[model samples]
Target: MATQVNPPRGMRDFLPVEKRVRDRVLRVIRAAYEHHGFEEIETPVVEDAARLHAGLGGDNEKLAFAVMRRGLEVDDLRAAAAPLELADLGLRFDLTVPLARFIATHRSSLPPVFRAIQIAPVWRAERPQRGRYRQFMQCDIDIAGEPGITAELELLAATGDALTRLGIPDAFIRINDRRILFAALDHAGIAPELHEAALITVDKLDKIGPAGVAAELAERGVDGERLLATLEAIRAGESTGAGGTLHGFDAAALEPVRELLAANAGIRLEFDPTLVRGMGYYTGPIFEIAHPDLPFSIGGGGRYDGMVGRFLGRELPAVGISLGFERLVDLVSLPEEEAGETVALLVDKEVEPTRAIAIKRDLVAAGQTVRMQRRTKNVTALLEQLAASGATHFAFVRPGDTAATLEVKPID
Candidate 1:
């Protein structure tokens, strides 16, 4: 019997071509970020289990992959009060929490106001589906210690530049504030405790529409039709303040956010009163990137003025945006691995090794991507194989052929 082999469920293994494209896309994204003066940083894939469960990662904390302790006796397991108690560490579910911890550990070494970039894989124990995965990459840029909307503007501009460079189609950001959401709930006569439940339904407004949200909210003992109408009015740039619906909402709460929205953020920003990121730590404006073709967002982030402070023992402001790398990979249409004129150096089996190396060096020095392959039985099949793998040109090396004398032919 043959054994069935596969990567872990919800995980993936990229083929050579797929990997090449991914690297290229990553490079483009990195360049865009660096152009905006954001420096890249790295953190351990695993963090202390306590930090992972620190109530800052929102629902992502629930999906963290716990790493059990290295040495646990049977008695310890029996004595354990909770499953996670046996685990000392967990794979980080998102980059933000780790970033917060990172700054706390490296505060003295970093600048007072630090702009950092992190591109890495994070693990989540999710029920994998089309766009969701157990293991996936997140590209995040965060500004820490700058206490104003400048950080938000910088993140938006930089993220927009990356999207532009990737040529993401019809991408826009929907902006909202936690304050706005709470005010909407309050104005709708929904109890404070039901705010979370109402926001959950509101986030689905696009998919379920007003009627559906009303139905769902009604089930929770709150009629939300008026709430949805008020949100719609806000979305249309109409103020409900004159009608007394925006009560408990400090107009100043939106002053800075309005300034952020009005800035030339380098991308379209639509104020959404119903937008809720579900991250409990978001203390201010939150946003998500939307595309015309997709039912879901590709990326988003917002201010968490309270998170970093929790780690550093004092409140420090921080905000970041993450590009949903997996979704971006699906949406991006890039030319497969175009690294200039690639040359396949087909060396005859009898050719001297030194001679082939010398020839390859010359082609490489000429700025061509060079790959040396021993001549095979079926030369045409070999050329086709090379061409399929992104070889654009080919050169033959025989016993006496010099690098200067060899003819380089186009693969096609």
Candidate 2:
């Protein structure tokens, strides 16, 4: 017996119909980004291990898919001091990091402010679940060299337009600035060093709830009561449809963001005080797109002004938004098959082949899809085959017809 073959775990093989739907979705998404003046770019699927494990990718760093050293480099594994030294490169977990490296490497040749659209597959060593895969596509748009809230506004606008075009009915763009979060922690009397520590716990607010968050913060020896009160106050604030204010951060700080939201009609904005986007690299405003139907974010991104500096010698402010292509695809309806008229040209075995060819040419010229097939006495089987191939119209070229005239009829 032969061993059964299948796509590797957490990967998939898309059939023709599936690929069609995926392509259509990609087109819609690409148009949205391109319309915003973003040019497409591609980077290597493999990236330096040093960068992958550099603690910049947030929790995703723990899930880096390392590519083992090969050829002459394989010898180093035997004498390497640590696992990190054994592998030179690994599959990229996200597009943002690679984009930074790309900018640093190609800055001189590229525009000072690079607006990029990266649509590619990224690999991660994550535990796969429904709507989650080890290998999935990410559609991202990032603006490098922009140092203001205007960058965040443009990123959100492009992202929101894309989702709307894709037919995602209702979604909330939950916005929060990391600066505000840090200020809130500072006001709560948390030490500067423990700010990230508290944030890591607070990031689980959506999953664990305030009580769970307080309990975890208490275990960390912080004043959980103080932190919980801060969160509760912000959550209970006035429902402005746009996001409300956090305690320590003055509401005036968000005036620019609020003004941007008011002018951008059709954008459902909400200032979520507890919205802690988990990524460590997000320097300023961070946001996530949430729909009531899905348990997870369909898209999110934020300003990472320091990431480029970490690679390049200088700090270059940048902001980006990424759509979860896999999760977004799951929410939208698949593209339906077009039901255009099709003609299967069934030529009798004894008929001159030119007769059938002429009929097919005529049908094709008339804007109908035509498939040439040999005529068979088994009418039932022939009809079944035509129906299976989705041929809506079929034609018969009989051997007795001297003029090669074809009587084309509806498949029904």
Best by lDDT: 1
Per-residue accuracy of model 1 over 211-269 as CA lDDT, tens digit each = 89899989988878978876665555534344233445445556665787668988888
Residues 1-412, model 2: lDDT tens digits: 9886887788899975567678789989999889988999999999999998888899998888887777635567667887777778999999999999999999998888889999999998778788778899999999998786667777887887888888875877888778767666766888988888899999998788878988999999888778767755654653534334554545544455456556673468877767888899988878888998778898898889999998999999999989988887767784554678877877788887776676667767777788888878897689787776567777777776532356778876
Q: Evaluated with TM-score, which candidate comes out highest?
A: 1
Candidate 1's TM-score reads: 0.88
What's the true lDDT of residue 168 in model 1? 80
Error of 1 at 399 (Å): 6.0
**Clashing residue pairs for model 1:** none
Report lDDT (Cα) of residue 182, candidate 2.
69
Q: How well does candidate 2 score on lDDT at residue 85?
A: 72
What TM-score does each of the candidates earn? Answer: 0.88, 0.82
Residue runs of model 1 more than 4 Å from their true location after superposition: 236-250, 335-338, 347-368, 396-408
Native-referenced Cα lDDT, model 2: 0.81
What local distance difference test score does each model get? Answer: 0.86, 0.81
